[model samples]
Target: MKLALGPLLYYWEKQTVETFYQQALTSEADIIYLGETVCSKRRELKTRDWINLAKQLADAKKEVVLSSMALLEAPSEIKILRQICENGLFKVEANDLGAVQILAENKVPFVCGPAINCYNASVIKLLINKGMQRWVMPVELSRDWLIKILAECTQLGIREQFEVELFAHGHIPLAYSARCFTARSENKAKDDCKLCCIKYPVGRPATTQEDQQVFVLNGIQTQSGYCYNLLNDVPSMQGLVDIIRVSPSGTESFTSLQDYRAAVNGTGSPIQLASKECNGFWHKIAGFQTQQ
Candidate 1:
């Protein structure tokens, strides 16, 4: 199975973002996705910068893909999405229906990102017909659900038409909203608010009254409280998944990528699940619960 580095979901300093991808040049990841997928206001890096970075990674013999924003709330966002689709040098991961439409209209083969509401084989078939070269299964879906969907695709003889990717690691992106939760948390309005999300490199953790961690607030994106890990489940993903995506959180992400690589190669010791890690979604259980 191939390892892919998913796009950065949280905002960070411009240098930090550049440094992360520079280190990724030698990481175990086979494919690297670059972009600002959450809020367009996070201008630490612009569209030109992302395309330039993608070019650098492609020159290093790594498969590079430009990711589109999950939510486009303005015409300017659509303009940026069009630029991403027209990047011609690398594949684009369509995160929303508008991106999908743009890519399809341009006759560009793209990867359907997990953010897209594609739950069944019918949608996969439709996307495949529209030049979708790969499909990243939505994070909320379970292994059983994926098996059923792939079976249906196989029955339709379109299973081999595209590759299947799984969001195997990192915090699960739960949802995206028009409101900026991070800005609101500081009693600031969405428009006049500064880029406060950059202050929290990973994301601000949200807890319940009982101090139980529930979710993470990253600008407009809400993520799972605990990291979603599947290092121990790599054996089961061998034949089913073509790419295993690990969302970059920080410097330690490269280490996690190494561990995942070792696990995939059958050269590592048994991995210990951290206290704040969960993999229940893959086992068809509560999302925040760890099966082991």
Candidate 2:
């Protein structure tokens, strides 16, 4: 299966984003997704900047896809989405239904990001008709759920029309809200907040009353506290998945990519890092629990 670098979910400086992609050019990842998929307020890299970076990565022979924000709160955000769709270079990863509608209207082939609600074959078939070239399985679905969806697709004779990508690694993105959890954590209102998300590169962590890590707060996006690792499950994906996505977290993400590549190639065992790992969602268990 091909390895893809999922879009950067955390906010980073322009220099940091540039350096990460530069390193990604030499990494084993075959596909690279660029653009901000979270809050629009995190504009470290604007639309033009993202397009320029996409051009650079495309020039280097890396398959690039521009990702859209998961939550679009205003018309300005829709304008930004239009600009990304009209770029005419790399593919676009539609994170929400509005993006899917815009892409459908433009007749642009796009990748359906995991955040998009594609739960059934009817939705899959509809998206395939609307120029969906690939679809990332929703993070909450299990392997059996995917099998059932694919089975329905097979019955409909549309299984091969699009590629299947799994959110193989990284902290699971659970939800998005109108309120910025990060800003709230800093005792600031979402509107008047001074872009506090940039301060925490990966995101601010939220723990339970027992001091047990439970969630990560990044702007309005809520992610799982534990890092979702699927290195051991690579073999299980074999022919069912076309690509495995590894979401970029921080400076350590590059090494994680290398390790994932090794695991895919059977050259190395799964790296057991210091972070808590979970694959329960993939195994049809509780999202935060480990079933392996």
Candidate 3:
């Protein structure tokens, strides 16, 4: 299966973003997703910069996709989405209905991001009719759920028309809100928060009273505290998955990508980075629990 690097969910400085992608160009990731999928207020790199970056990656023989914001609250954000959809170069990943509508209206084929809540074959069929080229399975769905969906698609005779991309690695983006939890955590309002999320490049951890991590707070996004890993499960996904996505995390993200690529090629074993890892959602259990 091909490897894809998911968009950066946490806010980072312009230099950091650029440096990350520069190194990513040489990484084992076959597909790289650009643009901000979190708060639009994090404008370290503007629309033009993301398009240019996408162009750079596309020129490197890597499949590039521009990802849209999951929570769009302002008109300016919609305008940015329109610019990405109308770029006429790389394909766009629709995270919200606005993006889907925009891409559909423009007669452009788009990939459905994990945030789009595509639960069954019927929804997949509707999106396919609207020009969806691929579907990134939602982070909460299990292997059996995907089998059922694919089985249903086969019954409907549309299974071969699209590809399946799974969010295989990284912290799961659980939810997005109008309220910026990072700013709120700093006791500041979302508007005048002074870009507090930049302080936590890896995101702030929300721990339970027992000192156990429960969630990760990154700007407007709420992510799972444990990193979601499927390196060991790569063998089982041979025919079922077309692409495996690895989300950017800490400084070891490139190493994680190497590990995933090696595992996919059957040359090396999966590397354990974070102290905690979760494959529970894929096994149909509590999202934080790891399953063998």
Best by TM-score: 1
Candidate 1's TM-score: 0.99
After superposition on all C-alphas, the RMSD of every candidate to the true structure, in Å, is: 0.7, 1.2, 1.2
Looking at model 2, the pairs that clash are: none
Model 3 TM: 0.97
Give the per-residue lDDT of model 3 (tens digit) for 1-292.
Answer: 8999999998899998998898888888899999999988888999999989988888888899999999888899999999999999989999999999999999999999999989999999999999998999999999989999999999999999899999998889999888889999999998999999999989999999999998999988899999899888888888899999999985588887888788888997655545688888988898899876
Q: What lDDT score belongs to each candidate, Candidate 1 first?
A: 0.93, 0.90, 0.91
Ranking by TM-score: 1, 3, 2
**Candidate 2 at 201: error in angstroms?**
0.8
TM-score of each: 0.99, 0.97, 0.97
Off by over 4 Å in 3: 270-274
User: C-alpha displacement of 274 in model 3, angstroms?
Assistant: 5.6
lDDT of 2 by residue, 9-116 (tens): 998989999998888888878999999999898888999998888888888899999999999999999999999988888799999999989899999999999999
Instruction: Tell me how far the alpha carbon of residue 264 in candidate 1 is from the true structure, in angstroms, after superposition.
Output: 0.9
Q: How far off is residue 146 in model 2, in Å? A: 0.9
Residue-wise C-alpha lDDT for candidate 1, range 1-292, written one tens digit per residue: 8999999999988899999999999999999999989999999899999988988999999999999999999999999999999988889999999999999999999999999999999999999999999999999998899899999999999999999999999999999999999999999999977888888898999999999889999999999999999999988887789999999999899998999899889997776788899999999999999976
